[model samples]
Target: MTEQNVDLGKNPRANRIPWPPLLLIASIAAGALATWVWPLPWPGINDGPAHGVGLGFGVAGIALIVWAIITLRKRGTTFLPDGTATSLVTSGPFARFRNPIYLGDALIVLSIAEITHSIWFVAAALLFGILVTALQIVPEERHLESQFGDAYLDYKSRTRRWI
Candidate 1:
């Protein structure tokens, strides 16, 4: 039997616990809480214009997420962390970032940092990136590699994981 035919079933890693969105939420909450309890005196621009820019970043992030979702649904693919993807999405934001949703999440975190004037949120964004990469992206990549074989490999070769 061919390698691709080994397990063309539901994603093997779908059963893993601690969903990606939950991880992101946890990271953001932790950062916000930390900032509230122990505000970091980081010296940087976090004023009216900065907050406005932060809001803009948040809008952009939300827009990216919505665009991705629309593209995925149109392609008949799943966006849920545990749901099986029906196809390898390679258009829209996927063309630029392999994990646009995660990128959006990062942008939202940055938004929080700027809006709240807290460096803790910046750290939170980084932590979220590392955690999601380890807990979600890696598994999803493996699953996609198994599901789409060379098509996915080729896409991975051309697409950036995050941008």
Candidate 2:
């Protein structure tokens, strides 16, 4: 993709701050607050099956995140969204998904929702996904497309954004 092809100027807020972790934290806090103030009855949240599902998802999410981080580090690329990526990494978890870390984050949010028995966390997860897409993923994609050009585009085409 050409520089002109990617509209980096569409969201000014995206480039200003490190939003991913902050957004995740904010979502969790909001969910927790909501749960405290107005706890909704989630029927199966306390069940053994629900806890098992949450545990499984949490493990998978953490594993995916760690794998992605290791892959980026091994390739000498910056995993931080705001940092300049030294290399276009397309191995390990990256081979399967362009945004494995973000996917992991999303999974962790779901895990939290299940573990905490909070319907509000499910809402938070949805909100977090939407906000991160607009504020982090879109900008990051534009930057990558601009920085890596056709190679990034090709990788993007072959690999799903989230799996």
In terms of lDDT, the best-performing candidate is 1
Superposition error at 103 for model 1 (Å)? 0.4
lDDT of 1 by residue, 19-117 (tens): 678988898899989988999886667577877889998999899999989888888767888877668888889988999998999999988888878
> Per-residue lDDT for 1-163 in model 2, tens only?
1122234343323256778899989998999999999999986647788799998988998999999999888876677777765567888888888889888888898899899888898899889889988998898887777666788889899999877
Per-model RMSD to reference: 3.7, 4.6
Best by TM-score: 1
Q: Give the alpha-carbon lDDT of every model.
A: 0.83, 0.81
Task: For candidate 2, give the lDDT.
Answer: 0.81
Candidate 1: 10-residue stretch with minimal lDDT: 1-10
